[model samples]
Target: MDCLAGSARAVPRWRNVAGASRTGKPVIVPGLIVANVAVFVLTVVTAGSLNRNFASPWFAEGALVPALVANGEYWRIVTSGFLHVGPLHLAFNMFALWIIGREVETVLGRARFVAVYGVSLLGGAAAVMLLSNPLGPTAGASGAVFGLMGALFVLLRRLKLPAGQVIGVIALNVVISFTIPQISWQGHLGGLVFGAAVTAALVYPGAVAQNRRRVQIVAISGLALLGLLLIGAGAAFL
Candidate 1:
């Protein structure tokens, strides 16, 4: 449900104190990629083909369906983020994730990175549940991947580095979302907005500031509440 094509060039910035806590190689991003690939393999095997996985019971049970969500299958918001329509869909999203997610992880460290991703994923699902057809299926990590792009943009700007490249990438992807046949523009926009907002809350806590972690926790939690509210609104609309 996303047309996440092309790679964005990484923005340059010095590692901040938060990133200094990162003592070793990044495990979260690699682990996410592996999980996505494994789930895709399972879906493909279940359906007996690369292209026909959508008809598999996995999709029936997992992919975001507004009608089903309204019926209390709320797990779709999380599970659908791991589902993809095909190999091309998976490749595009995971490639984008690998390119953008590692940098975000290195900058924010593992836990904060996961927080941003989780919030952005939920934001995307909320948007889809609100705006997309109630019975139509939508799935992909592009929403979460788009969230990484927003985080990178905010982080680059926080360091006073040039951020035009990130903006260009976002703009281009927005264009693709509109032009492509099946791309979920709603999910893309929601992820971008929430990603930037959450990352701003995360990195804007000054390095030497007191209660910085507490402030970040509150801000992220608030955004998560807002996303949940939006999901409720979507379900109500259905």
Candidate 2:
């Protein structure tokens, strides 16, 4: 099966729509993996005994985590997605993305994939801000990965695909989350929920494509609102 097949298989089924080379092929997702790997090399090399936040460039942040720290940077919300605390961390997440992202992006198209990813990242960030101690910082692409998985099954359901395996895949990750320390459970769960919502809205049949658009707009708006609220709340604590 192709990239689109993997995503659609995660839960429900959605047919493929042909596109240009970028969205039609499998290169973009792996390219992202390479980019992330390159960044991690820099992070590990820099994060010696002297600097605790050496890998700060990899984590994502905004008004909440970065805004609180004196030396913290603001663009972490996007940057953090590229950073991994250890080889294992990076490998696992990248692998998951490669397997899931390719198919989802292929099916959703690049622009929509980007949209789904961005919303999921924000959703992950929002969850961290709301639940975690404001003073503490959380980062990783697992949230984004989790988001993709959630999207797969939900998207399939909307298109009338089988959803039997989706729950199993999700539960496996959740088990890993509880068993793994320093893993961002908030981010994972948050991203998963956000991705599902977005995919569901996008693919959900409503008698008219316009209705689907309405569903997506409302869902995206809700996630954005929640992220902004977390930013505000984090600022308050600081």
Using lDDT as the measure, the top candidate is 1
lDDT at residue 22 of model 2 (Cα atoms): 38
> Stretches of candidate 2 above 4 Å error?
1-22, 48-73, 205-207, 210-222
Once model 1 is optimally superposed onto the true structure by TM-score, how far is the C-alpha of residue 128 displaced, in angstroms? Answer: 0.8
Candidate 1 residue-wise lDDT, 1-238, digit = tens:
0111101122223335333253256689999999999999999999998998887798779999999999999999999999999899999999999888878887777889999999999888888988998998889998898999999888777766677888999999999998998899989988988898899989786545567788888989999999999999999988
TM-score of each: 0.91, 0.78
**Root-mean-square deviation of Cα positions for candidate 1 versus the true structure, in angstroms:** 5.1
The deviation in Å at residue 224 for candidate 2 is 2.7
* Most accurate candidate by TM-score: 1
Worst 10 residues of 2 by lDDT: 12-21
- Show where candidate 1 strays beyond 4 Å: 1-20, 206-208
